[model samples]
Target chain A: MKTLLNKDQLNITLQRLAHQLVENHLSFKDTAIIGIQPRGIYLSDRIAHMVRNITGQKRIDYGRLDITFYRDDVQSRDIQVPSDTDIAFSIENKSVILIDDVLHTGRTIRSAMDALIDYGRPKNVELLVLVDRRFSRELPIQPDYVGHTVDTILTQKVKVYWKEKDGKDEVVLIDKV
Target chain B: MPLSVKHLLGIKELTVQDIEQIFQTADEFKQVLQRPIKKVPTLRDTTVANIFFENSTRTRLSFELAEKRLGADVVNFSASGSSVSKGETLIDTVNNILAMKVDMVVMRHSASGAPWFLANHIDASIVNAGDGINEHPTQALLDSFSIRERLGSLKGKRIAIIGDIMHSRVALSNIYCLAKLGAEVTVSGPPTLIPKHIESLGVRVEYNVKKALEWCDVANVLRIQLERQHKPLFSTLREYALFYGINKQMLDGLKKKIIIMHPGPINRGVEINSDVADSGQSIILNQVENGVAIRMAVIYLLSGKKDAQLSI
Candidate 1:
């Protein structure tokens, strides 16, 4: 099995992603990072931690969003968990960075963005994905930030296992050979 | 392949197995409470929209907390703040939200069966918080949960639900849930308010509270909102309270073990006496706490199953 983004490479990718966030985001103040729940949440937390360490800012709020209930795929999949929007701090007028682990067909990001707008309008919503796999997006959507891009067959699957979840930090491309 | 119930529209939409599955799942999720962290990552990437077309701070907040604790995102839309107040039809507003791709919808509308309409139109799972006074299935589930917790079993138990039967969705859902679980159900209310053919659902019906009170292990008092007294259903509030309210004396009429229950924001001295409301046997707060647990089960079960298939 060929490993993509081994532990060290994953660390570098996260650090680069963190630096990219710092460079792209104009101000640390009034900026909030909300991770799409499950994998995105951990990614966002890491991003937030990296941003804080790099910029030495302490006021930015990091939140987790579970977009289960607000899904078009509700008919196809059983929502294992109810959606949770745990924003301890208010999101009104704040600039939000919507973070996710992967960008596939762009449906989940669209849903996450939809979920974010309901909390109260943010000054801006920038989409950030760890991996950008070029697939046929059903909607006209694109990520504002990306860590890496990959081209794969439609039948192939990308499995992202983080140390916090699968006891390792790695991304695996599983092909239907 | 778990049973998915994203939005609960009404009890009418649920099969007996569907109802049983929810109760069972609620039983499992109840364990989370015993842990230090009362949260689950089941809905780790999902978001729930709480669309309330009615004024209900309690149900809205309960659903919100339930979603948050289960690790799902919650988006709230109230009639006052949302576009509905600006002459937007319920369909238009829901479609707009659906465009954003919400996973499930827990709706409470002033009009009866509005959530059903939304379920038909949208792809989100629908949980009917309250549809006018037609049905509050979760309230019924919580009420049943409280009863099951107190009695340990429901078979052959005499459970009497009193007050505003005609306009009480709580009474309607409770009747179905309790009867399904083998409770000897009796509904007592003014005949004017008690709808026709209600007794056909296999529950005994009575107009006199005293007669109903004498034969029950649990006397579940339904709230008597003044708004429900619409068009002079009753001549005087005092007369109604005196005649029907569950008070200290009424407690004596029943066996000492008969528990008192109310789905509150209580009418206080109106539907139930303050002493009874605050009494040792009052399961009102228990109902509130259990409401969340039952709702978590509902969200978990409802959201976990796919729409096109009935079996999970």
Candidate 2:
């Protein structure tokens, strides 16, 4: 296992991502932040919190979306209990930011895109990820904002741990045997 | 996560955890239904056959809609105007369908334990739509879901199952599901319509519908199935309505507001009056709406039991 980002480095990365978001979505009017459910929630929650502080906004249109039903591998994989998809606000004609912890094969992003169609049509969607596993994407999905980019083999797994959920904040690459 | 059993034959065979798991999953599907593009692609590769040996409208259509919403390939079969009338055996008919690469079967039959027998013989997962006075597991699930959605939780909730308990697959299923969820259930109807020794199922028996309505938080009134009754259990439909039918007057008489629910095809003035059925406290329509979500949850979980995986 190789540690990619330590405690202090992870904190700095989060702040940088938040600033980048505020810089692009100044005043945050028609833009909505959506965290892909389960893992993406950890990263988006922290980023959304930091953006709220930086922009001095009380609350932004942020929601969590679960793409389990939209996944293509339902027949093949073990069906796990789905996380809550709490998109309480409308995303119609709004610039949406889809956030996640890591971008692997891009299948999840594909599923999330399909899942998002049910909600009102967004003006546009941009992908944001903490770690982008370069050269591993099966779909042509590219991330707009990336904290770190890593080149990894097929068997290696990228895992991001949060302080709230995993007792610490860090990123690690595990070589699956 | 995987459901404990391969086939959902009856609620009696499900543990409380399994029921809870299904409920939790159904909660997610409920949100999916709210979306403008309500269809999900999870079951695209899986084909389901909805075989109804018995006639139905709501339950059958509910299952079909659930299957369609989940992106499943659905094949519908009915006994009437089918090969069943041509003296085809149950196993032979099902095996023929399975031969067409069907992965699951949703069935409703006139014989009790029909789904159980099918589950034992077939490899495909069998969901019991309703089997002759046995257990309509999904109906009970959606009913409980509707109650929980309205009243928050089922634990310690007083739910009175009123009317035609002896002939209702729904009442039996509801009793098992509610009891497992720490809910107190009561079977209330005319003594003749309710089965003997039903109290052994850990439910109270009330002969008076008014008394049951006065006692419970929710009254899950069941329809008096005239077709299922071989002989007249009660004197007359008018007399039955006068004594047992739930109406606006009963709610006004009750000290507390009691939720009213029915599975479907309500006998209108017989089991429940039109006024009460259309009342503010009635969650009968919500039960129908939740049926698709509950079914989608069950089918998705059971589909996970397959050992197949994409070669990634």
Candidate 3:
């Protein structure tokens, strides 16, 4: 079955995620929000804003991380390229939530986790993804908090877009076959 | 809260993944070049401003090419006729052009960390074309790209960055990138010009250039800043050449399969002899060409299309 999170639903999901994060981990003192570059950064920002409102003030620092280089499968492909990875702030010891739009084969998140560790070790590294399309596990990694979960076949693609990051808001699924 | 920049200050703020994406995207651009048209509409309607506070021919021209080829309107700015010469502050000058609502600003400055300063105040997206002697990120990207193209992989490769480590922004940036990408980087230069804390960045420092040249797969010769002689770093041009220049004889002692590189506008016989600069293994021109595509990747990413489905 195909499931999609419309704008309203996605907003609600984000609100709940923020509340859960606050309830599960009390106090925003050592909490830092890091969005995976591209989409995760927007979610991280949204979550940070929510956290600030809940605490009645700004209580968390945030950063954006790009994990394109840390991937293990780069050179095996036909292209061997590198790009700019911008993190406006430092990623010192703090509770970091590595945000990404979707969690699929888990390779991107895996690489992002590795890349984050290189910057510095955070006290707690949590994974928060918008969509979790269940499939066979590549690495033994799972999301700490998932907005929605759907079972899917291997020959499909899960896409997520946000107005702040992708110029629109919606989630779509496509048949790769 | 998150902020947007109209310019890229430096790669110091960039993580390995962002850089890797640039390389991956540039690698895609390289494939595009193989075709007959060799152009894309990815940056169509975007206006790119090349605001150079310092003089640069290759970097400026390459950025222009990258912008135009991506179908963006390109504007070239220099300090020669601008208000900068009249003692206008950088903020005032940047604020003036930003008022025009340009899409992006690609800048090169002489003062270290000047780009970061601009990024802090501006709302527009910024690409640090070159910032002082602090970072030449695109240069490092192109250099790394060229090395990967020739040597297959950057894993465990030994690279020696020779000359003026303390004064060479290329050396500083390269050490961070090369080391991050898994290259055992060694920086060799004169004792006075080599900073004491370079090893902190995971690079070994050496004072003897000849010895360093013999031990690596790649030898990056930094341009001897002719302007530094007056600052008491070195006595004379001839003295500088005698000690650190990459002459043809020095090339023979190093591994025959080694690659030679420079960030360009070479001083000919000073940092590198013309023969070595023009040698078969010299990837200087390739670096210049790769620089355009690599910069295109940087501009695309900093354009804030990170979440968009960017298809080549």
Each candidate's number of clashing pairs is 43, 2, 27
Off by over 4 Å in 2: B305-312
Poorest 10 consecutive residues by lDDT, candidate 1 chain B: B303-312
Q: Which prediction has the highest DockQ against the true structure?
A: 2
The 0-to-1 C-alpha lDDT of every candidate, in the order given, reads 0.79, 0.91, 0.76
| Candidate 2 structure quality by residue, lDDT tens digits, B1-312 | 677788898999898988999999999999899888788888888899999999999999999999999889999999999999999999999999999999999999999989888877888888999999999999999999888898899999999999999999999999999999999998999989889999899999989888888889999988889999999788999999999888798799889888889998988899899999999998888999999999999898888647523110
Question: What TM-score does chain B get in every candidate?
Answer: 0.94, 0.97, 0.92
By TM-score, how accurate is candidate 3? 0.63
| TM agreement with the true structure for every prediction | 0.64, 0.97, 0.63
Q: What's model 3's lDDT at B291?
A: 89
Choose the strongest candidate by TM-score.
Answer: 2
TM-score for candidate 2, please give it: 0.97
Q: For candidate 3, lDDT tens digit of each residue in B1-312?
A: 011322445555556676667777887566545444566655565788889988889999999988887667887889999889999999898888888878788888888888778877776777777776688877888889889889988889999998877777788778878877889999887887888887888888878887788788899889877554447787877888999988888787655668999997899889899999999979989898898888877776565333223211
